[model samples]
Target: MIFFDTIGTMAIGSRLRMLSERITEDARQVYELYGVGLKPKWFPVFYVLSQNNEKSITEIAKEIGHSHPSVSKIVREMSKDGIISEEKDKNDGRKNNIKLTSKGKSLALKMENQCFDVKSAVDDILVQTKHNMWNAIGEFEFLLDDKSLLKRVIEQKKKRESYNVEIIPYEEKYKQTFRQLNEEWINHYFKMEEADRKALEHPKEYILDKGGHILIALYKNKAVGVCALIKMNESEYDFELAKMAVSSEAKGKGIGWVLGKAIIEKSRSLNAKKIYLESNTVLTPAINLYQKLGFKKIVGHPTPYERCNIQMELNLG
Candidate 1:
């Protein structure tokens, strides 16, 4: 139960397996009591071929949503037991069609009558559990067939990373976070200049004391990103939006977007009429975020940092 609760959604495979194992184990015991030799797993292929009379290994696998090798292995065991046989297709020499032997036919007929008991037992369990297990399984299979489990898992990962990110005001505890997150991006793409170091090493002295605001993005209670709006002039609510960085582990999760939005809203609250920023053209994603927030390219007189080739501004009325 602890494992079930702990694993949660991760327990899908195990839970499904347990359901099958429990029911199959009971059915196996039932078969033993009835003195039947067939296994529960063999029913799908055997039952399908009984109706069709002749189906290739590939056809059996496709009918049951099982792999060809798995169907072939079952066919081999059935052949060994003298319960089924294969014949080369007259139209295609490479293809072999499967057929039920006399023994297999006899067993299918006898078990067909007893299958009602198995169905009733399963239905009883479903009733007790307050679930229609057959319908549930059918819907689950239909869902997976419509969109494969792998594609669904991939989309979930991307959505989880990008959609739910949150940004919060910076605190004294996030001193290292501001520095580390910035340093990671700066040092990786370009060398940390003296201007960058002065701000990174002492974020409070360089940014906060200078009438600027710093913001951080948190994912699962951990600060994974930082951004700042540096006040440019003593006269007006003009600010320079800079020092934005998202940790490598949190890059694709839209942390930058969250942090940037927090900075924009903070500037608006501070009566910021205009916001300016400096960046390199190489940082396309970062630039795109600015554009999304109505920041457009503009020519500025001068900049303190050497790496600042492209300048952008947002006019907030």
Candidate 2:
């Protein structure tokens, strides 16, 4: 019986491997149609260029975890193909800077589109092959590892029990809690004068009067996190998911992601065309979570919130 079970498992694994190879081949064909010569090895070069422009060969090599000689050879081939250009750095004569050419930029865009299509196709296939298999696999991996998934589940349960938070439209009673939470955030990170803190804590009456709504996350009937959605104009929506403060006692309880998802759902329900947020780069975990949730980085805006070093945006409509 054990031998038969082992043989069946091996057969299933072999079939899955063959299917994956077929998917890869299909993806390559799609790339070729776009006139882009994409290969597994060339990905490192593109990944470095995507992050920052005009990086030195040494910097690119370091970022991609390749030896300098290997990267130099690849760059030489890429340059000969008219995909990248190399120039001597003016300030550092010994260093060579690599920049993507027009062809390279076009290829990058095409590759992105093709990759998205391939992902969609694979997702559809998996959905059809076995219902809820992805979720089951994810849970299995979580269990096999350091029990991270189980830990997250336990944390979520605790949060649910302690918070029992409800999402509601802006109300006068929430103003005091919002102010208090905002102050707590400022104190936790930014050192500001009493008057300055008070100024920020003072809710903008104009925003409230102009059809703005706030969502507060509460624990034991005490406000813990807050997000605001403001109508920018007749046809536009602006969101300030700020004042998102979780009580120190409730830290590491997955409250942030929950609140973030709730805020996004609320924004969509309100027919928001776009949602914008201001944050600091020092909070890497928060930034990563935002990225995972489909937020994209944007330039800093001219706003009164000077402490907000990072800006992110999401398009709903």
Best by lDDT: 1
Q: What is the lDDT, from 0 to 100, of the residue 115 in candidate 2?
A: 66
Pick out the ten consecutive residues of candidate 1 with the lowest summed lDDT.
Answer: 155-164
For residues 1-317, could you state the per-residue lDDT of candidate 1 as single tens digits?
68888989778899889978997898788888777788878889888988888999999999998999999999999889888999999999999989999998888888876788877876787888866778888999899989989978866775677566667777889998899888888887888899898888888899899888888887887888889888787533399899998888876666776677788899889988999889999999889889988898988548878888998888899
Instruction: Count clashing residue pairs in model 2.
Output: 0
TM-scores for every candidate against the unseen true structure? 0.53, 0.48
lDDT of 2 by residue, 203-259 (tens): 566456666666777655666777666556643336656556666766665667777
Where model 1 places Cα greater than 4 Å from the true spot, the runs are 1-9, 148-317
Instruction: For candidate 2, give the lDDT of residue 305.
Output: 64
* Superposed model 2: Cα runs more than 4 Å off: 1-163, 192-201, 233-237
Residue pairs with backbone atoms closer than 3 Å in model 1 (clashes): none
